[model samples]
Target: MIEACQVNRSTFFQCLNGKRLPKESFFEHLLRTLQLSPGEESKLRKLYHIAQIGESVYQNRQCAKKCLETLAALSGNLIPQIYRLDGVAQLTANWASLEGDNRVFQELCHLVQAEMFLPEPKIDLFVPQEDSRFIEYLKVLYRNSGEKNVRLRQLVQFPQGRGKKTRESMEFFDSILFFLASDCMGYEAHYYYSEVDFADTVGVLYPYSVITSTGVLLMNEAMDRALFSAAPAILETCRTQFEDVLCKTKQFHTPFKGYQQTVDFTLENWEGTTMGYQYFATPCFSAYLTRELVDKYCPAGMEERFDHYFQSIMAGVFYVSFCSEAGLMDFARNGLMNEFPERLVPPLELEDRKTVLETMLYRPPENSRLYLMDPEKTTVSDEFVFSLAKGKRIMTYRKRLPKLRMFCFQEQNLMDAFEDFFESLPESSYVLPRSEVERVLRQAIRCCEEQMTFDLSNQIG
Candidate 1:
């Protein structure tokens, strides 16, 4: 093949042996000399390019590991309190007279604020990639969005390739905080995957944009030039383009209105064999709840439905649940569950709760595993519980009130982050090892049993 390709034998051998990368000409010549079919040639060319760029599965794995670590660290701090910009001074801008891109961007930020002040305000954004300049824009949108009746819809690239993920393209995790920060504040994202380079496909025409009913700001890729338009024709054209692009996309983030919708979504995507992970303040009660327990404790009309949901959640599945020590003690003492309303379901009896802990220790389901999370070692929140099922979805349930809510994240790239996050937790310093967890469970069981005896003695006295 080297002879047919008119390449030096030693150089060709070096390339084959991984000592040196194949040159573009040499790679193409070798493909021609081999008389390979179109598919074979394409695959080889891709492999050659990947080798030249030093992209490997190992690098992607390492990148993914780092991203997961960052995510775990940022988990507790993801939600930012909504800021009111009431007294903030608005920047005055003559759009046509704007000289620099930075000035235009500032003006655009002001425009976004103006839109937010309107009743029923909605902002449409097209972000081709994780451009640094737009971070400020996103910040503005999320900060005040908490209190205002504002809506944010974003169109973002999936940040991947046609085949395996590339290290350079794995920026989804970097922008995940933005997606999660505004989750409760009327935020939605639609995503699309391009067979070609994602940035190259959309970046040329619409690198970054913020569109509202009244105005539009289009920023160049360099972040140094922008076009601001309030003309009806220009605004309509941008709106049409956004809708056209949105039509080719799929919804990336989903918000569950209530328990029924959350349960329905879970059952519809159920995977029996997948090992799952949960991060909650206490053990996942759904996995441990028996039919009788559900019938006894579940709300009046929700018995059969809750029972079915609980059974479906646990059936033929393995799970590793991370619980806080304080939460376990509370469960052992008060029988309180984060998921169910105490008024409706009521706390379990001391003996019943003891039995549940004992079952977890001795006769636990074959698929169940528990780990204790050290509060001092991790930043995970008690208000949020994350349920991750492989190849299914990651459900985040917020137990705090005004109202309870669930957010479902099912995008593949985001799922990969959660999967890595979960897998890394078993080895994380925040989560206790199996032996430590077993010791704690025994302690909790003994505490429950002693509490039961004390109450019985008091009644006798």
Candidate 2:
């Protein structure tokens, strides 16, 4: 390979190790560098494009295998247009509505530094920032995102909601044979009391947002700080609230199976002092409203008490995540829905708002808190998420129409322009097994984006 490249073996090996990206002009050398088969050059070029697009979307070992399969699909041709974006869906609509106060949005704007990268960069739309602190901002923001596609400032005003469309063409000749792409966009069951929360589908409609009930408090700092360790105490103070609901209903179902019959134990400190842990089911708002009573007004030794149990309770949330690399989604099959293969996000056109509503697909029982149709009996479907009725065309509720169309048009144009312009919309996607984790990430990202923006704006002021 080295001799074919006209470089010594050492230099050739260096490029292979990622120590160096071979100069663009040298791409042709690859034909001989690896002693490729006939017509391999074009295929290798297309693969590079795929890798570049995917680098932003996936970051695990499984992603690597998916990439290889994509390369194999091309069969040795550098056909850029050899791919197709025809079926690709724009998932970034309303995602671009950069709410003025979103921190993640500000962080991305600050981190990208268009002024530094582009000639005669317009500083007008840019936030005045402390360049020194901006890098740190990216690190912390990325950490909280758990390697998922939580766009910056997107929470305050999502591009789709804000009338922006996904403007990219993530075309590849053929999608790989793997389903890893669908890992994002679903809820995790472990977080809720169990999948039974909506009969198992509570998350499908209200999602963790159900917890954002009026009385739930929002304490921003406690979460932003590496305060993960501090939450257990808060949970200890709030455990009874969860238990009380179960006790009241006379069916305290735990996500952990077979424990329904386990004798309930009143939470007590090491000294055996019984304390009430009831706060609110929706802890984000609960934390906000109860901040003074919790973060500030810990009952005497309560802060010193229940610390251990608090940790255990938080763990029960069972947090895991997957992110979108570009602003679009690709699903040869539905990974989130265990019963069917479908694209969770629907594709939108230039001026079309394709409101995406993920139905747990199965109706829950009347007494079901969440939409859980015994997994033993229920199944996922092949129904496309955006096109719930692409073929079947069932009537969605009247209320779903306004926001539904609203969600569609906002993303349609943006989706059109982005895919056309950027060649792809890399989705930083996420799938949460625990509603709490899903809830917290959504709220915190919103808050963090808002906080950073407000803080930066203040500094500029």
Candidate 3:
């Protein structure tokens, strides 16, 4: 082949042995002489570029790792190709274009089917729940593969309130259950209802490989590009983020029979479990607890029914009391006071209220110790009194809750900083013993009752 290409055998051998690098011109000429196909030639060119980068960065560990990642990605059997289109109308056209490029579709199908053949296969997805077509595609893929063992982990946005788009969001949740019920696929879905919305990127992680895209490929809202990689570092990073989000979000279970039926199921199975409950004054929190309390306690008897109803009504009031004078009072007054006066008549901050709520909710086992860090005068409510009477643990700080600049568990420095901030709080901030809590709560409630006169008959009515 070298002779035919008019190249010296020694020079050709040197290039082949990696002792020398070949110019693009020489590489093209070599491909031509070997009569390589267009696809093979494209792969070779990509490989060459990767090789050049690898050689330049060989001495720098970090740079070398990156180079190696690029090389591995280019060399993989499934390299994602970018398809540019004008708008949503072009999605069908672009998909038709992909029909001619069976390699991409086939690779995706192979990954989906891997769950059936490979032992303990896992797939992770980071995506927007509003994309129904993507969910449909997954359903079709799972149905076609007939694989029952594939474990799917997804990170999806669950909007915080029943706003204009709430119906659409609820439909998406229903669709998830529909997909799950269609097959015996082992799957877990995490709902991220945070203040920060992640970039519209979809990532899929398999046991041996990873594939990521700019947006839902089945939809036409965002970029139509993807990246496929077998690089360990890249895969690990994707896996880590998927896991971090999983750790920070709530696990959503399938509502098989119906929404109300599922509620009944949860109450039956989860009643009396010591849950570390965190309350924040959000429509989502109010809606969720109302259903939970009603479902769990209303079914027991008339007395239990009234208790749960009263707790549900007071939950919001309790949250407002905690927020008052901590900087959230104005927000509560302006946004929620009128509509929820029965609940928010007591009125509320620190940093953004959402951030405080998310931080409090996401910080697990530690959340069992309720943090009452409102730097203002201690305000107690019926709910607070009831919680203390029920022996719930509490923690208090003289200072308000600190704003977390960053909350990435993977970054050791950030984790260390978080720990330092938490540990630095004065030990005196810890709440007194349970007996003290009962005493304080009782006195506060008595004071409140005396200050706010009410007809005793009205409560019975």
Candidate 4:
């Protein structure tokens, strides 16, 4: 700031952080020195707030870790407060797992109390909850944990005992969270205690609820809501549950079907590959714990795969540049993706984006840009998008008539791109083409606009 404004360092730095205003003479000198425009000033203001928030996360690291430590120690029944304090605690747990901070973990555990006592805070649930049955199961499971088998069973049976299966400890987190997050047609609370076998893999129970022609938009609208509401929870639960399974499973009755066991990958044309190991053994369990052991005790091969993730994300962008030209990404499919569907625009500050744009209209023969420019080569493959993360075909369609194949190519590119983008970041916010890194935000804005339109239309009608 000082160098740009030709002002003294102290005042310039202080001003940026909103610490103190410089003297009029200082301000005049600084303003003239910088030659800023009104629009630039506004952008700078926004950036300043973002930077502040980033700093706060750094500061709160210890708090999140504490939350998690608390969670691991808790053995009592589930408190209703768990539901109430859901958001912030969930955020902290996820942050701790990814960032490895005691503060966030501690904050995660503290959530049990927060939800019980604190009024719902000033935030929305990204992943909406439809049925409370799963929450009920959670409550039961929490209470049952340390009890003798008989007492544990007795505790769980208290929640009306209508659910079909005895709440397996695994199912407590899996079936419960999945049911809460997903809305399968044939699957219901009734199905849980009954004989109906609705097919789903991992935790998801896919319904035969087919979207009709007239209901296409309706399905999309409902989908947007469900995904928005449950995404955070889904991601968080999956991380915890799978990591727990990975970390603790010396012996188990049920096999660890890879995370994408039930999803079809035929969309990208890479359909036949059966993913027995990677998705289940690692992807679902220890994303942050990469293969190459960093320091002393991390996973092996994490660092290598991270590089591949970057390549795939760029491949996603390359596909977007060719298919949409405008850099827009479309919704891929259900049960398979963690990110909202949309293409990422490169940021001005990003050297990668600069390199991409430089080669867009013209580039050397061997350049990747030349390959991306090809409509044929650039097209997303049915095998890529439709195929499961490890190449399995989805056996069931949850919502839409499994309009699964129409855009599998883009979705595959999207899936890998997201993997690359997310895996590379230190925190969720770094989960940007990041807001910090993204130069072009039109794609995100478009999603927001579309969501608002659906909301308004629903409200008006």
Separate clash counts for every candidate: 0, 97, 6, 67
Query: Between candidates 2 and 3, which one is better according to TM-score?
Result: 3
By lDDT, highest first, what's the ranking? 1, 3, 4, 2
TM-score ranking from best candidate downward: 1, 3, 2, 4
Task: List per-prediction Cα lDDT, in the order shown.
Answer: 0.66, 0.25, 0.37, 0.28
lDDT digits (tens) for residues 1-461 of candidate 4: 56756677787878868797555566556556667798876565545544545543322332322321232223122244433323244332322221222332233234323332323211111111232333453344343232222100111111223221222221322333222222211111211122332233344422211111111000111222111112454545543543343343221111112223212221222223323111110011112212231222212443443344433333332111111112222211011121111111111222222222333323422212111112221222211111123322211112122211111112122233323322322333212222322332334334445555676899999
RMSD of 2: 29.1
Which pairs of residues collide in model 1? none
Compute each candidate's TM-score over C-alphas: 0.73, 0.19, 0.30, 0.18
What does candidate 3's lDDT look like per residue over 383-431, in tens digits? Answer: 1110100112211101111210100011122122222223322232322
lDDT of 4 at 179: 22
TM-score of 3: 0.30
Of the two candidates 1 and 4, the one with more favorable lDDT, higher being better, is: 1
| Model 4: per-residue Cα lDDT at residue 172 | 28
lDDT string for model 1 (1-461, tens) is 77876789899899889898877788778887889999988788767755754555435545644543444544343544433433322233323434465565566667777787787787898754646555555565665555666677887765356334343334554455445534345777787765555345654744678898778888765555667777778888988998898898888767877656654555444455367777777777667766677677877776666666666667766777878777788889888776543244588988788778888877778778888876665544466666777887777655544445667777766666556656766765667777876787788888988998998999999
Runs off by more than 4 Å, candidate 4: 1-78, 81-138, 142-175, 178-303, 317-461
What is the C-alpha lDDT profile of model 2 across 1-461, one tens digit per residue?
56666766776787788686666545567666666766686678756655554543322223322332342332222223211112211122212212222343342333233222332221111111122233234323233333343222101111222211111111210121111112111111111112122224433331111011111111121112111111334434333453343343311111111111110121111112221111011111111111222333233454543344343323222211112211111110111221111121122221111111111112211211211111232221111111111111111010111111100111232223322221111121112234533343344334434545676899999
